[model samples]
Target: MHLDPFELHRPTSVDEAVRLAGELAGRFDFLAGGTDLLPNYKMHINLKPHLVALDRVSELAGHSLSRLGAMERLSRLEQDPAFVAAYPGLADALADLATPLVRASGTVGGNLLLETRCFFFNQSYFWRASLGFCLKADGDRCHVVPQKERCYATFSGDLAPPLLTLGATVEVAGPGGRRKVPLEKLYDTEGDGIRRLRLAPGELVVAVDLPDGAAGQRARYKKLRVRPSFDFPELGVAVAGRWNSAQVDELKVAVGGVETYPRRFDELTEALVGGPLSDAKVASLAEEITRRLRPVHNTFLAPDYRRRMIGIYVRRAILEAREGQGG
Candidate 1:
């Protein structure tokens, strides 16, 4: 196998890194853990040029929980509990990504910025060469199911699904300046070239601002894959908001490993609002969900099977959230 040649850049500071990234513009690729990028290079899937490693940028690594600890004061209020409760689900989601060894080296900024995946596309150049290139690779068509105009790669990151459910905002530093945007909009609908991530040239994701969920809001991350662990999701669901209350308030639903971005079925969520949370209601909502999702045959499982499981997982997620909320 032939390895692609690429230049590597390591800046000592975030400011320097951002500047370097800005100067390099679209020509450079950002390196985090190299778990995904290295394999792509080895497979000849990408001919990388000017790799800017973010490892030297200390600001992107390490996180603080002191803010959540500060919320302990709110426990004093008898009528309303403190916001410390919101951290558990977020912490749990972060803790659940990959294994401990990977976590030590992996950064939150990298995980959130990871590229979308497709079983048919994320292969060695040899594999794609044999099958011919799909839309995501060098090829012009989708191999999973031909006659498609765009790539059908699934966004396989586990953190993104749950983070969107929590209403997290991403902070990125670029040449123009620093800005924050809803993490949900970071992905684009067009899957052929990379999904719509608003990452500007010379921009680096710094930290993500996660809005604390309400005291009653409960969230869960459920992923379906061939293996029980270590494998990327074939279908992932993240459900958040106050499902435990008698009246449903704001709800956030995001699904991954099935589409270009984490998909939020707002139309379906609206159908369930103000209705009793029941098995019957769940069943009815499942139909709406099925209508909204269009999964392709790109993962380990069949597209039809994946589509069917979408409803199953959505129903199960709601039930689980309700149970957690004491509904």
Candidate 2:
């Protein structure tokens, strides 16, 4: 498939980019890495009339130990010794994401805001047309769940789970002003896959900020996919916490690629914070996570299998984190 013609605007600064986006409104899409958006465009899914390319925006490319610019390349972060050492779980997720060539061009912001995928939504134009279209693109109803008011497309990103577990925040700029919100808040749990993100019109993600002490936490990311080489995650579980001599001091768990958004188990984490890291506790936590998540038949994997793997992966990730802590 080939890309349909559209005007591309290269904005030099964030202010200029926001202004252009505000003017273009519903007709434009922000181009950072184009690793995800360009392919979707080729499939004729959510095609925009204009494109605001952010490659020339110098401010969006900055990175440090604590703050990572949204436009920072995935491959750059994966290969950087200091970055990898500081955030091993994040580094692992990046390493497991797509192939090296795609990772070299995939941006952190793009991955965080990756589009929800489904068997019906991500298809060639003719293939979708034969099925009368789906809710995400040209049609009005959802084919996956056959719902008139909801879409069941799955969020297939790998970076979000680990970042959420790390308690990262994101800086966003728009016509109103700049503001920072917890990275988990970026997703709209109340909305369907067609309208998943909570970001307003013309808003751009500036940077992702990790708290000062986040790097010191013991963390692990476990992913399950059809192929180990370069496939989108079927199930991803990320766990992070500090251990106090075989006991949990602090804890956070986030799971992705199951539903409309990446979700964190606050209650489970709070309950386990002061408890001992025993096999029984880990098994209970895993069982609760499996009960809470409801993976549908949108991806290549079966719903029941994916749902079961969530518990297994979560259990394995927590144990791995515990082992890393030498507890």
**Candidate 2 local distance difference test against the native:** 0.90
Off by over 4 Å in 1: 1-5, 65-96, 190-196, 212-216, 243-245, 270-275, 325-327
Clashing pairs in 2: none
Give residue 169's error in model 1 in angstroms: 0.9
List model 2 lDDT by residue over 63-114, tens digit each. 8889989999888888788887878788778878989999999999999999
Superposition error at 173 for model 2 (Å): 0.2
RMSD of each: 5.7, 1.3
Model 1 has how many clashing residue pairs? 4
Best-fitting candidate, scored by TM-score: 2
- Candidate 2 deviant stretches above 4 angstroms: 325-327
**Candidate 1: residue pairs that collide:** 21-202, 22-202, 133-139, 188-196
What are the lDDT figures for the candidates, one per model? 0.67, 0.90
lDDT, candidate 2, at 151: 86
lDDT of candidate 1 at residue 69, scale 0 to 100: 14
